[model samples]
Target: MRSAPRSMSEEVIPLVEESAVVGKREVVTGRVRVRTVTDTIEELAQADVQHETVEVTRVPVGRVVETAPEIRTEGDVTIVPVLEEVLVVEKRLVLKQELHIRRRVEQEAVEVPITLRKQRAIVERTDPEDPAPEGPPT
Candidate 1:
Protein backbone atom coordinates (compact mmCIF):
# COMPACT_ATOMS: atom_id res chain seq x y z
CA MET A 1 0.00 0.00 0.00
CA ARG A 2 1.15 3.53 -0.66
CA SER A 3 1.49 6.08 2.30
CA ALA A 4 1.11 9.85 2.26
CA PRO A 5 4.06 12.15 3.09
CA ARG A 6 4.21 13.82 6.63
CA SER A 7 4.07 17.58 7.38
CA MET A 8 7.22 19.66 7.96
CA SER A 9 6.45 20.40 11.72
CA GLU A 10 6.06 17.21 14.00
CA GLU A 11 5.63 16.70 17.83
CA VAL A 12 8.29 14.85 20.04
CA ILE A 13 7.48 12.30 22.87
CA PRO A 14 9.75 11.19 25.82
CA LEU A 15 9.72 7.70 27.62
CA VAL A 16 10.45 7.26 31.42
CA GLU A 17 10.82 4.29 33.92
CA GLU A 18 9.17 4.21 37.41
CA SER A 19 11.44 4.37 40.56
CA ALA A 20 10.85 4.16 44.39
CA VAL A 21 12.91 4.78 47.62
CA VAL A 22 13.24 1.78 50.07
CA GLY A 23 14.18 2.08 53.80
CA LYS A 24 14.48 -0.22 56.89
CA ARG A 25 13.34 0.12 60.54
CA GLU A 26 13.67 -2.00 63.70
CA VAL A 27 10.64 -3.66 65.42
CA VAL A 28 10.40 -5.44 68.84
CA THR A 29 8.91 -8.90 68.27
CA GLY A 30 9.34 -10.49 71.71
CA ARG A 31 10.72 -9.99 75.22
CA VAL A 32 13.06 -12.17 77.26
CA ARG A 33 12.80 -12.63 81.07
CA VAL A 34 15.43 -14.27 83.29
CA ARG A 35 15.38 -15.32 86.97
CA THR A 36 17.73 -17.14 89.36
CA VAL A 37 16.97 -19.91 91.87
CA THR A 38 19.11 -21.12 94.77
CA ASP A 39 19.22 -24.55 96.39
CA THR A 40 21.07 -26.07 99.37
CA ILE A 41 21.98 -29.71 100.17
CA GLU A 42 23.60 -31.47 103.14
CA GLU A 43 26.46 -33.93 102.74
CA LEU A 44 29.14 -35.63 104.86
CA ALA A 45 32.86 -35.57 104.03
CA GLN A 46 35.66 -37.61 105.70
CA ALA A 47 39.33 -36.75 106.00
CA ASP A 48 42.38 -37.91 108.02
CA VAL A 49 44.09 -35.25 110.19
CA GLN A 50 47.32 -35.75 112.16
CA HIS A 51 48.41 -34.18 115.45
CA GLU A 52 51.47 -34.78 117.72
CA THR A 53 51.81 -34.66 121.56
CA VAL A 54 55.00 -34.29 123.54
CA GLU A 55 55.78 -35.63 127.06
CA VAL A 56 58.76 -34.21 128.97
CA THR A 57 60.53 -36.03 131.86
CA ARG A 58 63.51 -35.05 134.04
CA VAL A 59 66.18 -37.70 134.87
CA PRO A 60 69.02 -37.28 137.37
CA VAL A 61 72.53 -38.35 136.26
CA GLY A 62 75.47 -37.33 138.47
CA ARG A 63 78.68 -37.84 136.46
CA VAL A 64 81.99 -36.00 135.70
CA VAL A 65 83.04 -35.03 132.16
CA GLU A 66 85.84 -32.95 130.60
CA THR A 67 83.35 -31.19 128.25
CA ALA A 68 79.63 -30.85 127.81
CA PRO A 69 77.84 -33.49 125.73
CA GLU A 70 75.97 -32.50 122.55
CA ILE A 71 72.12 -32.76 122.37
CA ARG A 72 71.03 -35.92 120.52
CA THR A 73 67.77 -37.44 119.31
CA GLU A 74 67.08 -41.19 119.18
CA GLY A 75 63.94 -42.33 117.31
CA ASP A 76 61.13 -40.08 118.65
CA VAL A 77 62.90 -39.34 121.97
CA THR A 78 65.29 -36.37 122.43
CA ILE A 79 67.96 -36.22 125.16
CA VAL A 80 69.17 -32.80 126.44
CA PRO A 81 72.11 -32.83 128.90
CA VAL A 82 72.64 -30.24 131.67
CA LEU A 83 76.13 -29.43 132.99
CA GLU A 84 77.58 -27.47 135.96
CA GLU A 85 81.09 -26.33 137.03
CA VAL A 86 82.34 -27.33 140.50
CA LEU A 87 85.08 -25.42 142.45
CA VAL A 88 87.70 -27.74 144.03
CA VAL A 89 91.47 -27.84 143.67
CA GLU A 90 90.72 -27.01 140.01
CA LYS A 91 87.57 -26.36 137.95
CA ARG A 92 85.76 -29.50 136.76
CA LEU A 93 82.63 -30.05 134.55
CA VAL A 94 79.91 -32.18 136.20
CA LEU A 95 76.68 -33.59 134.68
CA LYS A 96 73.71 -32.19 136.69
CA GLN A 97 70.58 -33.72 135.06
CA GLU A 98 69.00 -34.71 131.70
CA LEU A 99 65.60 -33.96 130.12
CA HIS A 100 63.91 -36.62 127.95
CA ILE A 101 61.19 -35.58 125.43
CA ARG A 102 58.91 -38.17 123.84
CA ARG A 103 56.39 -37.57 121.05
CA ARG A 104 53.11 -39.50 120.50
CA VAL A 105 50.43 -39.38 117.78
CA GLU A 106 46.73 -40.19 118.20
CA GLN A 107 43.68 -40.34 115.86
CA GLU A 108 39.98 -39.68 116.52
CA ALA A 109 36.70 -39.12 114.65
CA VAL A 110 35.15 -35.63 114.35
CA GLU A 111 32.04 -34.20 112.73
CA VAL A 112 31.29 -30.65 111.60
CA PRO A 113 28.22 -28.86 110.23
CA ILE A 114 28.50 -26.93 106.97
CA THR A 115 26.20 -25.12 104.53
CA LEU A 116 26.41 -25.29 100.72
CA ARG A 117 24.46 -23.30 98.15
CA LYS A 118 23.76 -23.72 94.41
CA GLN A 119 22.11 -21.36 91.93
CA ARG A 120 20.38 -21.82 88.54
CA ALA A 121 18.89 -19.47 85.93
CA ILE A 122 15.45 -19.77 84.30
CA VAL A 123 14.42 -18.04 81.04
CA GLU A 124 10.94 -17.13 79.77
CA ARG A 125 9.94 -15.55 76.47
CA THR A 126 6.83 -13.46 75.74
CA ASP A 127 5.49 -11.85 72.54
CA PRO A 128 3.49 -8.69 72.03
CA GLU A 129 0.44 -10.29 70.37
CA ASP A 130 0.66 -13.72 71.96
CA PRO A 131 1.53 -14.36 75.64
CA ALA A 132 3.54 -17.55 74.93
CA PRO A 133 5.01 -18.97 71.72
CA GLU A 134 4.95 -22.69 70.97
CA GLY A 135 8.28 -22.78 69.11
CA PRO A 136 11.12 -20.42 68.27
CA PRO A 137 10.36 -17.58 65.85
CA THR A 138 11.82 -17.75 62.37
Candidate 2:
Protein backbone atom coordinates (compact mmCIF):
# COMPACT_ATOMS: atom_id res chain seq x y z
CA MET A 1 0.00 0.00 0.00
CA ARG A 2 1.22 3.53 -0.80
CA SER A 3 0.65 6.42 1.66
CA ALA A 4 -0.51 9.80 0.35
CA PRO A 5 0.66 13.03 2.02
CA ARG A 6 -2.10 14.78 4.07
CA SER A 7 -0.54 18.19 3.26
CA MET A 8 -1.61 17.78 -0.35
CA SER A 9 -5.12 18.55 0.86
CA GLU A 10 -3.83 22.12 1.56
CA GLU A 11 -3.37 22.65 -2.20
CA VAL A 12 -7.13 22.14 -2.76
CA ILE A 13 -8.44 23.86 0.43
CA PRO A 14 -7.34 27.45 -0.32
CA LEU A 15 -10.02 28.86 2.05
CA VAL A 16 -8.36 27.45 5.25
CA GLU A 17 -6.30 29.99 7.22
CA GLU A 18 -2.56 29.45 6.88
CA SER A 19 -1.59 29.46 10.64
CA ALA A 20 -4.39 27.11 11.78
CA VAL A 21 -3.32 23.96 13.69
CA VAL A 22 -5.45 21.16 12.28
CA GLY A 23 -7.31 19.11 14.98
CA LYS A 24 -8.61 15.53 15.04
CA ARG A 25 -11.34 14.74 12.46
CA GLU A 26 -13.49 17.85 12.87
CA VAL A 27 -16.51 17.17 10.63
CA VAL A 28 -18.56 20.13 9.44
CA THR A 29 -21.73 19.31 7.54
CA GLY A 30 -23.44 22.47 6.27
CA ARG A 31 -26.17 23.13 3.70
CA VAL A 32 -25.37 25.13 0.53
CA ARG A 33 -27.97 26.81 -1.70
CA VAL A 34 -27.81 25.57 -5.27
CA ARG A 35 -29.89 26.26 -8.37
CA THR A 36 -30.89 23.21 -10.45
CA VAL A 37 -30.63 23.17 -14.25
CA THR A 38 -34.04 22.26 -15.74
CA ASP A 39 -35.19 21.54 -19.30
CA THR A 40 -38.50 20.45 -20.90
CA ILE A 41 -39.00 17.56 -18.40
CA GLU A 42 -39.78 19.60 -15.28
CA GLU A 43 -40.60 16.93 -12.55
CA LEU A 44 -37.06 15.42 -12.17
CA ALA A 45 -34.40 16.60 -9.60
CA GLN A 46 -34.58 16.48 -5.76
CA ALA A 47 -34.55 19.88 -3.90
CA ASP A 48 -32.05 19.28 -0.96
CA VAL A 49 -28.71 17.52 -1.78
CA GLN A 50 -27.33 18.13 1.75
CA HIS A 51 -24.46 15.62 2.24
CA GLU A 52 -21.51 18.10 1.92
CA THR A 53 -19.15 17.55 4.83
CA VAL A 54 -15.49 18.06 5.78
CA GLU A 55 -13.36 16.17 8.36
CA VAL A 56 -10.23 17.63 9.97
CA THR A 57 -7.71 15.50 11.92
CA ARG A 58 -4.38 16.44 13.42
CA VAL A 59 -1.20 14.43 14.28
CA PRO A 60 1.27 15.62 16.90
CA VAL A 61 5.03 15.55 16.41
CA GLY A 62 7.28 13.52 18.75
CA ARG A 63 9.21 15.33 21.47
CA VAL A 64 12.12 14.35 23.70
CA VAL A 65 12.82 15.18 27.41
CA GLU A 66 15.97 14.52 29.48
CA THR A 67 16.80 14.48 33.24
CA ALA A 68 20.39 14.76 34.43
CA PRO A 69 22.09 14.26 37.80
CA GLU A 70 22.33 17.24 40.17
CA ILE A 71 25.80 18.77 40.49
CA ARG A 72 27.19 20.46 43.66
CA THR A 73 30.10 22.87 44.04
CA GLU A 74 32.99 22.13 46.45
CA GLY A 75 32.08 25.20 48.50
CA ASP A 76 28.81 23.55 49.55
CA VAL A 77 30.55 21.39 52.22
CA THR A 78 31.97 22.96 55.44
CA ILE A 79 34.06 21.64 58.35
CA VAL A 80 34.44 23.33 61.76
CA PRO A 81 36.41 22.28 64.86
CA VAL A 82 34.90 22.44 68.36
CA LEU A 83 36.69 24.56 70.95
CA GLU A 84 36.68 24.48 74.83
CA GLU A 85 37.91 27.01 77.38
CA VAL A 86 39.87 26.37 80.64
CA LEU A 87 40.08 28.80 83.57
CA VAL A 88 42.81 28.88 86.29
CA VAL A 89 42.26 30.08 89.87
CA GLU A 90 45.05 31.19 92.20
CA LYS A 91 45.13 30.40 96.00
CA ARG A 92 46.82 32.47 98.80
CA LEU A 93 48.41 30.73 101.77
CA VAL A 94 48.00 32.32 105.27
CA LEU A 95 51.03 31.07 107.20
CA LYS A 96 52.60 32.45 110.50
CA GLN A 97 56.41 31.73 110.37
CA GLU A 98 57.97 31.73 113.88
CA LEU A 99 61.72 32.41 113.74
CA HIS A 100 63.81 30.55 116.23
CA ILE A 101 65.45 32.61 119.15
CA ARG A 102 68.75 30.80 119.61
CA ARG A 103 69.30 31.70 123.31
CA ARG A 104 73.11 32.08 122.93
CA VAL A 105 73.63 30.46 126.37
CA GLU A 106 77.12 29.55 125.22
CA GLN A 107 78.03 26.81 127.73
CA GLU A 108 80.91 28.55 129.31
CA ALA A 109 83.52 27.35 126.89
CA VAL A 110 85.12 24.67 129.00
CA GLU A 111 88.50 26.00 128.21
CA VAL A 112 89.10 23.14 125.75
CA PRO A 113 92.63 22.27 124.81
CA ILE A 114 93.33 23.87 121.40
CA THR A 115 93.88 20.34 120.31
CA LEU A 116 90.16 19.32 120.94
CA ARG A 117 88.79 22.62 119.40
CA LYS A 118 89.13 21.16 115.89
CA GLN A 119 86.38 18.53 116.62
CA ARG A 120 83.22 18.04 114.38
CA ALA A 121 79.83 16.36 114.84
CA ILE A 122 77.28 14.84 112.41
CA VAL A 123 73.44 15.22 112.92
CA GLU A 124 70.28 14.18 110.91
CA ARG A 125 67.38 16.68 110.53
CA THR A 126 63.94 16.70 108.83
CA ASP A 127 61.94 19.95 108.30
CA PRO A 128 62.89 21.92 105.19
CA GLU A 129 64.95 24.46 107.08
CA ASP A 130 64.39 28.24 107.26
CA PRO A 131 67.32 30.70 106.89
CA ALA A 132 68.93 33.19 109.38
CA PRO A 133 68.08 32.13 113.00
CA GLU A 134 69.17 35.03 115.36
CA GLY A 135 68.60 37.09 118.61
CA PRO A 136 69.10 36.27 122.38
CA PRO A 137 66.65 33.60 123.72
CA THR A 138 64.75 33.17 127.11
Candidate 3:
Protein backbone atom coordinates (compact mmCIF):
# COMPACT_ATOMS: atom_id res chain seq x y z
CA MET A 1 0.00 0.00 0.00
CA ARG A 2 2.53 2.63 -1.10
CA SER A 3 1.73 4.85 -4.10
CA ALA A 4 1.86 8.65 -3.80
CA PRO A 5 4.95 10.62 -4.89
CA ARG A 6 5.07 11.16 -8.63
CA SER A 7 5.92 14.70 -9.76
CA MET A 8 8.61 15.39 -12.34
CA SER A 9 9.14 18.36 -14.65
CA GLU A 10 12.11 18.75 -17.00
CA GLU A 11 11.83 19.95 -20.58
CA VAL A 12 14.73 21.11 -22.74
CA ILE A 13 15.12 20.16 -26.40
CA PRO A 14 17.08 21.91 -29.13
CA LEU A 15 18.87 19.91 -31.78
CA VAL A 16 19.65 21.39 -35.17
CA GLU A 17 19.90 19.42 -38.40
CA GLU A 18 21.44 19.71 -41.89
CA SER A 19 25.00 18.43 -42.06
CA ALA A 20 26.57 17.29 -45.36
CA VAL A 21 29.76 15.50 -46.49
CA VAL A 22 29.08 11.90 -45.50
CA GLY A 23 31.99 9.53 -46.23
CA LYS A 24 34.88 11.85 -45.42
CA ARG A 25 35.36 15.19 -43.72
CA GLU A 26 38.57 16.96 -42.70
CA VAL A 27 36.93 19.23 -40.08
CA VAL A 28 33.56 20.73 -39.14
CA THR A 29 32.22 22.20 -35.90
CA GLY A 30 29.86 25.16 -35.68
CA ARG A 31 27.81 27.34 -33.33
CA VAL A 32 27.20 31.00 -34.12
CA ARG A 33 25.56 34.21 -33.02
CA VAL A 34 26.58 37.58 -34.51
CA ARG A 35 23.51 39.78 -34.24
CA THR A 36 21.70 37.36 -36.54
CA VAL A 37 24.23 37.93 -39.31
CA THR A 38 23.93 41.31 -41.05
CA ASP A 39 24.99 41.75 -44.71
CA THR A 40 28.62 42.10 -45.85
CA ILE A 41 30.47 40.08 -48.48
CA GLU A 42 33.56 41.22 -50.40
CA GLU A 43 35.99 39.16 -52.45
CA LEU A 44 38.62 40.10 -55.03
CA ALA A 45 40.71 37.68 -57.10
CA GLN A 46 42.96 37.46 -60.22
CA ALA A 47 44.74 34.45 -61.73
CA ASP A 48 46.47 33.83 -65.07
CA VAL A 49 49.37 31.42 -64.96
CA GLN A 50 50.91 29.99 -68.10
CA HIS A 51 54.35 28.60 -69.03
CA GLU A 52 55.15 25.48 -71.00
CA THR A 53 57.49 24.74 -73.93
CA VAL A 54 58.91 21.49 -75.24
CA GLU A 55 60.88 20.21 -78.29
CA VAL A 56 62.83 16.95 -78.01
CA THR A 57 64.16 14.43 -80.56
CA ARG A 58 66.71 11.66 -80.33
CA VAL A 59 67.57 8.59 -82.49
CA PRO A 60 70.37 6.03 -82.22
CA VAL A 61 70.57 2.53 -83.70
CA GLY A 62 73.30 0.45 -85.32
CA ARG A 63 74.19 -3.12 -84.31
CA VAL A 64 75.72 -6.35 -85.77
CA VAL A 65 78.70 -4.01 -86.03
CA GLU A 66 81.81 -5.63 -87.52
CA THR A 67 84.27 -3.00 -88.70
CA ALA A 68 87.55 -3.19 -90.65
CA PRO A 69 88.00 0.24 -92.18
CA GLU A 70 90.24 -0.09 -95.19
CA ILE A 71 87.16 0.82 -97.23
CA ARG A 72 86.12 -2.81 -96.63
CA THR A 73 88.46 -4.56 -99.03
CA GLU A 74 87.96 -8.20 -100.15
CA GLY A 75 84.90 -9.98 -98.80
CA ASP A 76 81.96 -8.20 -97.13
CA VAL A 77 80.14 -5.32 -98.94
CA THR A 78 79.59 -1.66 -97.90
CA ILE A 79 76.21 -0.13 -96.93
CA VAL A 80 76.79 2.55 -94.31
CA PRO A 81 73.76 4.66 -93.31
CA VAL A 82 74.11 3.47 -89.68
CA LEU A 83 71.55 6.12 -88.70
CA GLU A 84 72.64 8.47 -85.88
CA GLU A 85 71.98 12.18 -86.28
CA VAL A 86 68.81 13.63 -84.78
CA LEU A 87 68.78 15.78 -81.66
CA VAL A 88 66.89 18.90 -80.65
CA VAL A 89 66.09 19.98 -77.06
CA GLU A 90 64.24 22.99 -75.68
CA LYS A 91 62.08 23.26 -72.53
CA ARG A 92 61.21 26.32 -70.44
CA LEU A 93 58.36 26.98 -68.04
CA VAL A 94 57.75 29.35 -65.11
CA LEU A 95 54.71 30.22 -63.03
CA LYS A 96 54.27 32.49 -60.01
CA GLN A 97 51.28 34.78 -59.46
CA GLU A 98 49.77 35.88 -56.18
CA LEU A 99 46.97 38.37 -55.51
CA HIS A 100 45.00 38.94 -52.32
CA ILE A 101 42.07 40.78 -50.76
CA ARG A 102 40.28 38.71 -48.17
CA ARG A 103 38.46 40.05 -45.13
CA ARG A 104 35.92 37.68 -43.60
CA VAL A 105 34.78 37.51 -40.00
CA GLU A 106 31.90 35.44 -38.65
CA GLN A 107 31.21 34.13 -35.18
CA GLU A 108 28.37 32.47 -33.21
CA ALA A 109 28.01 29.96 -30.41
CA VAL A 110 25.14 30.08 -27.89
CA GLU A 111 23.51 27.07 -26.30
CA VAL A 112 22.63 27.29 -22.66
CA PRO A 113 20.41 25.03 -20.50
CA ILE A 114 21.87 23.41 -17.45
CA THR A 115 19.64 22.19 -14.58
CA LEU A 116 20.63 19.44 -12.17
CA ARG A 117 18.06 20.42 -9.57
CA LYS A 118 18.85 17.29 -7.55
CA GLN A 119 17.86 13.61 -7.36
CA ARG A 120 20.55 10.99 -6.97
CA ALA A 121 20.30 8.58 -4.08
CA ILE A 122 19.53 4.98 -4.85
CA VAL A 123 22.72 3.14 -3.96
CA GLU A 124 21.23 -0.14 -5.20
CA ARG A 125 17.73 -1.10 -6.34
CA THR A 126 18.77 -4.72 -6.86
CA ASP A 127 18.06 -4.76 -10.63
CA PRO A 128 14.37 -5.27 -11.23
CA GLU A 129 13.26 -2.68 -13.80
CA ASP A 130 13.99 -4.06 -17.27
CA PRO A 131 10.98 -4.62 -19.41
CA ALA A 132 13.66 -3.94 -21.99
CA PRO A 133 15.06 -1.06 -19.90
CA GLU A 134 12.16 1.37 -19.48
CA GLY A 135 14.61 3.82 -17.97
CA PRO A 136 17.08 6.73 -18.19
CA PRO A 137 15.63 9.33 -20.55
CA THR A 138 14.32 12.59 -19.17
Candidate 4:
Protein backbone atom coordinates (compact mmCIF):
# COMPACT_ATOMS: atom_id res chain seq x y z
CA MET A 1 0.00 0.00 0.00
CA ARG A 2 1.94 2.99 -1.43
CA SER A 3 0.62 5.75 -3.85
CA ALA A 4 2.56 8.78 -5.05
CA PRO A 5 2.88 9.65 -8.75
CA ARG A 6 0.84 12.64 -10.04
CA SER A 7 2.59 15.83 -11.17
CA MET A 8 2.14 17.62 -14.59
CA SER A 9 0.28 20.58 -13.25
CA GLU A 10 -1.62 18.03 -11.15
CA GLU A 11 -3.03 16.25 -14.22
CA VAL A 12 -4.56 19.37 -15.79
CA ILE A 13 -8.25 20.40 -15.34
CA PRO A 14 -9.48 23.93 -16.26
CA LEU A 15 -12.65 24.45 -18.38
CA VAL A 16 -15.63 26.91 -18.57
CA GLU A 17 -18.47 27.41 -21.18
CA GLU A 18 -21.59 29.68 -21.00
CA SER A 19 -22.53 32.15 -23.79
CA ALA A 20 -25.55 34.22 -24.98
CA VAL A 21 -25.57 37.23 -27.40
CA VAL A 22 -28.75 37.69 -29.60
CA GLY A 23 -29.93 40.99 -31.20
CA LYS A 24 -32.46 42.27 -33.84
CA ARG A 25 -34.69 45.37 -34.01
CA GLU A 26 -37.33 46.92 -36.37
CA VAL A 27 -40.91 47.55 -35.18
CA VAL A 28 -43.69 49.72 -36.69
CA THR A 29 -46.61 47.42 -37.30
CA GLY A 30 -49.71 49.10 -38.73
CA ARG A 31 -50.26 51.57 -41.57
CA VAL A 32 -52.03 51.05 -44.96
CA ARG A 33 -54.80 53.17 -46.51
CA VAL A 34 -55.70 53.56 -50.18
CA ARG A 35 -58.71 54.91 -52.10
CA THR A 36 -59.78 55.40 -55.73
CA VAL A 37 -63.26 55.11 -57.29
CA THR A 38 -64.67 56.17 -60.66
CA ASP A 39 -67.45 54.70 -62.75
CA THR A 40 -69.43 55.84 -65.84
CA ILE A 41 -71.30 53.84 -68.46
CA GLU A 42 -73.59 54.47 -71.46
CA GLU A 43 -73.71 52.33 -74.57
CA LEU A 44 -75.69 51.77 -77.79
CA ALA A 45 -73.91 50.34 -80.82
CA GLN A 46 -75.06 48.67 -84.06
CA ALA A 47 -73.46 48.22 -87.46
CA ASP A 48 -74.26 47.19 -91.07
CA VAL A 49 -72.64 49.54 -93.54
CA GLN A 50 -71.73 49.16 -97.20
CA HIS A 51 -72.12 51.62 -100.07
CA GLU A 52 -70.81 51.58 -103.67
CA THR A 53 -72.40 53.17 -106.73
CA VAL A 54 -71.16 53.69 -110.29
CA GLU A 55 -73.19 53.89 -113.52
CA VAL A 56 -71.84 55.15 -116.86
CA THR A 57 -73.28 54.28 -120.26
CA ARG A 58 -72.45 55.36 -123.82
CA VAL A 59 -72.98 52.72 -126.52
CA PRO A 60 -72.68 53.38 -130.23
CA VAL A 61 -70.59 50.93 -132.25
CA GLY A 62 -70.74 51.48 -136.00
CA ARG A 63 -69.19 48.06 -136.67
CA VAL A 64 -65.85 47.26 -138.30
CA VAL A 65 -63.24 45.56 -136.12
CA GLU A 66 -60.40 43.38 -137.43
CA THR A 67 -58.24 43.89 -134.34
CA ALA A 68 -58.32 45.72 -130.95
CA PRO A 69 -61.33 44.77 -128.91
CA GLU A 70 -60.51 43.05 -125.66
CA ILE A 71 -62.00 44.39 -122.45
CA ARG A 72 -65.08 42.48 -121.56
CA THR A 73 -66.92 41.25 -118.48
CA GLU A 74 -70.59 40.71 -118.83
CA GLY A 75 -72.68 39.87 -115.78
CA ASP A 76 -71.97 42.92 -113.68
CA VAL A 77 -71.52 44.70 -117.03
CA THR A 78 -68.12 46.23 -117.85
CA ILE A 79 -67.13 46.59 -121.52
CA VAL A 80 -64.66 49.31 -122.45
CA PRO A 81 -63.53 49.27 -126.08
CA VAL A 82 -63.47 52.40 -128.28
CA LEU A 83 -61.10 52.54 -131.22
CA GLU A 84 -61.29 54.30 -134.58
CA GLU A 85 -58.66 54.43 -137.40
CA VAL A 86 -60.45 54.63 -140.69
CA LEU A 87 -59.25 55.88 -144.11
CA VAL A 88 -61.93 53.97 -145.93
CA VAL A 89 -60.44 51.44 -148.45
CA GLU A 90 -57.07 50.70 -146.86
CA LYS A 91 -56.92 51.19 -143.14
CA ARG A 92 -59.94 50.22 -141.12
CA LEU A 93 -60.42 49.32 -137.48
CA VAL A 94 -63.53 51.19 -136.45
CA LEU A 95 -65.89 50.38 -133.63
CA LYS A 96 -66.34 53.69 -131.90
CA GLN A 97 -67.95 54.22 -128.47
CA GLU A 98 -68.63 51.53 -125.91
CA LEU A 99 -68.15 52.28 -122.20
CA HIS A 100 -70.73 50.68 -119.96
CA ILE A 101 -69.88 50.04 -116.34
CA ARG A 102 -72.47 49.42 -113.67
CA ARG A 103 -71.94 48.52 -110.05
CA ARG A 104 -74.31 49.30 -107.19
CA VAL A 105 -74.32 48.03 -103.61
CA GLU A 106 -76.01 49.85 -100.78
CA GLN A 107 -76.86 48.83 -97.22
CA GLU A 108 -77.11 51.25 -94.36
CA ALA A 109 -78.07 50.87 -90.69
CA VAL A 110 -75.75 52.37 -88.07
CA GLU A 111 -76.08 53.79 -84.56
CA VAL A 112 -73.33 54.52 -82.05
CA PRO A 113 -73.24 56.21 -78.66
CA ILE A 114 -70.77 55.07 -76.07
CA THR A 115 -69.02 56.32 -72.96
CA LEU A 116 -67.46 53.98 -70.40
CA ARG A 117 -64.96 54.31 -67.55
CA LYS A 118 -64.43 52.22 -64.42
CA GLN A 119 -61.89 52.07 -61.58
CA ARG A 120 -62.16 50.88 -57.97
CA ALA A 121 -59.79 50.24 -55.06
CA ILE A 122 -60.41 51.06 -51.41
CA VAL A 123 -58.50 49.60 -48.47
CA GLU A 124 -57.94 50.95 -44.97
CA ARG A 125 -56.04 49.74 -41.91
CA THR A 126 -54.30 52.42 -39.86
CA ASP A 127 -52.95 52.47 -36.33
CA PRO A 128 -49.55 53.84 -35.43
CA GLU A 129 -50.97 55.98 -32.68
CA ASP A 130 -53.68 57.14 -35.13
CA PRO A 131 -53.25 60.79 -36.08
CA ALA A 132 -51.71 60.70 -39.55
CA PRO A 133 -54.67 60.26 -41.84
CA GLU A 134 -56.19 63.25 -43.65
CA GLY A 135 -54.97 63.03 -47.26
CA PRO A 136 -52.14 61.28 -49.14
CA PRO A 137 -52.40 57.48 -49.30
CA THR A 138 -53.47 56.35 -52.70
Per lDDT, the best of the predicted structures is 4
lDDT of candidate 3 over 1-138, digit per residue (tens): 999886887788988988887596554243222222233344333344444433222323333223322322222223223222323263222112111222334444444444333334333222233232344422
Against the reference, the lDDT scores of all candidates come to 0.84, 0.31, 0.35, 0.87
Give RMSD (Å) of candidate 1 vs. truth. 7.1
Q: Which residue runs of candidate 4 sit more than 4 Å off their true CA positions?
A: 1-16, 21-28, 31-38, 41-51, 70-79, 82-97, 102-111, 127-138
User: Predictions ranked by TM-score, top down?
Assistant: 1, 4, 3, 2
> What's each prediction's clash count?
0, 2, 3, 0
Q: Give candidate 3 misplaced runs (Cα > 4 Å).
A: 1-89, 96-103, 119-138
The better candidate by lDDT, 1 or 2, is 1
Count clashing residue pairs in model 1.
Answer: 0
At residue 54, candidate 3 shows an lDDT of 33
- Residue 96's lDDT within candidate 1 is 90
Superior candidate under lDDT, 1 versus 4: 4
lDDT of 4: 0.87
Across 18-60, the per-residue lDDT of candidate 4 in tens digits comes to 8899998987788878788888889877899999999989999
Candidate 2 residues 17-98, lDDT tens each?
Answer: 6676867885434322233333332233334323333332232322221322122222422222222222326332222222
Residue pairs with colliding backbones in model 3 are: 31-108, 32-108, 33-108
Q: Evaluate model 1: give its lDDT.
A: 0.84
Measure candidate 4: CA RMSD. 11.6
After superposing candidate 2 on the true structure, give the runs of residues whose Cα lies further than 4 Å from its correct spot. Answer: 1-90, 107-138
User: What's the CA error at residue 12 for candidate 1, in Å?
Assistant: 9.6
Q: After superposition, how far is residue 45 of candidate 4 from its true place, in Å?
A: 11
